[model samples]
Target: MISEGRYKNQKAIIVENENLSMSFLPDTGANLASVVLKEENFEFMVQRPEREYRRVEFGGDYVEAECSGMDDMFPTIDRCYYERFPWSGTELADHGEVWNLAADVNVKGDDRVDFTFHGVRLPYVFHKNVSIIEKNTVRIDYSAENNTDFEMDFLWAGHTMLQAEPGTRVIVPEDCTCAQAVFTDSGRIGAYGEEFDYPVYRDKDGSLRDMSVMGERQKDSEKYYLKYPLTEGMCGIERTNGRSFTYRFPADRVPYLGLLQNFGGFREMYNMFLEPCTSPFDRPDVARLMKKNCVIPPRSAYDWYLEITVR
Candidate 1:
């Protein structure tokens, strides 16, 4: 079934089959707010905190209200100036320009839906399509086009967070090694940009810290971007109860996978993020410096896709 509805006081569109159900927010960032299994009622996506949500006025921040759930990061993740790109302006906002704006939702047939957003600050258009390909798998296809007469460089990432507890196991490709854990005020596991093997890192004090799971680490907050290439092109996290969520995407299209753990840190929220990004770094400027930013020619389009399965 397909229908329009409201979730968390925000406008949303829902699509479902016999086994899977998903919700998409059309007016706000076009976020895929929720995904769940029907019979078991097991939700796979992390939702925003339960509170009265008010639309932010101009110059107000939206981060405080829309931090959880799934979001699309485009153009850039970190704010910076545009250099080399045709656009002569500052980089995209905190999490990019889409989240702050509304999107147009189109229901394609019974099993597919598309959410589209046109850029305001830059000359570009982004489209995302969600389709239930199987009873257990949902496929997401993304396309971004440059509407200008010059080439543009940008970054894209699927900002997906999942509800996790102490026993949730976060899995990555076997080749994934060497990670950088971002430091935060609450406390950090390692230094910024410090490279260490996956799931295990030596702290400055020579103590080994495990990154494989978010376990009983209260007041701990850290962000890690893995340096290892996605040799297997698949990763996931499974709860201790045996329920799991797996993601599959081509490594050539999305090169980096980021792991964000906020255990009673960062506004006292507990959730973990399994992100797939086209570039290794989040900042456009940093990506440009590293020569990893994606390029779109004038009037040309770029396309990629990923799939998620509930097991």
Candidate 2:
């Protein structure tokens, strides 16, 4: 069922069924604040320590706000200037625009909530529908329209940060044998742009690291991009408690995948981000420079869907 609830002083829209329940704060970037597996009575989202939500500026830093759960990373992932003609040098927000603006929410009975957001700086409209489609499945349908005549390069990532433990392991397609190190905080893996064997990785000093499994809080964090489009388009995490959540998407629509490991590195938190995205990497300008970013046609719309099965 869908209900209006107050979560730690923030306006929350909760949609649930018999198996899963999701609570998202529409006022705070429409953040998916909570995801509970009903059978296990377990929370999947990484809990934010902040009790209250505060409004963020149009181009403010994302870290300054409540850094929790899933925040829609759109148009771009990192702070960069629009590189195309006419819009060149236009500064994009740190984690895109939607995360800072309030979304107009529409609740449909007990199973669906649709959020619509008109862009403040960019010329586009974004829509996301969060719904419970089955007892063990949650579905999210996403779409965006380019309101301008000029085509624009963009990237969209499903930035879901889940609570993780040492024994948790990440699951991907068998063919995704390697990944590129896109970003690193402590250089625990290798430098940026370096590619390594997946699951079983040999680090710089020849340390055999099973990258699929989580280790201790090593004060390090890194983001990895699958070198190629995932034809299978599947990713998930197996928790230590025997609860596993799997994500499935269309390979043609959301073909790229990224994995973020935050092992007591940034903000001293332990979590994991299994990002299913459009582009192979972050930063729209960089992706555009590499001729890999997706572009919405002039006056046209783009659409995709993400399905999650928790068991």
Q: Which residue runs of candidate 2 sit more than 4 Å off their true CA positions? A: none
Question: CA lDDT, every prediction?
Answer: 0.78, 0.85
lDDT of 2: 0.85
**Tens-digit lDDT track for model 1 on 82-138?**
776456665566677776668888898888888888887777899988888888998
What's the TM-score of each model vs. the native?
0.93, 0.96
Give the Å error, residue 238, model 2: 0.6
Q: What's the count of clashing pairs in each model shown?
A: 0, 2
Cα distance off (Å), candidate 1, residue 298: 2.5
Worst 10 residues of 1 by lDDT: 52-61
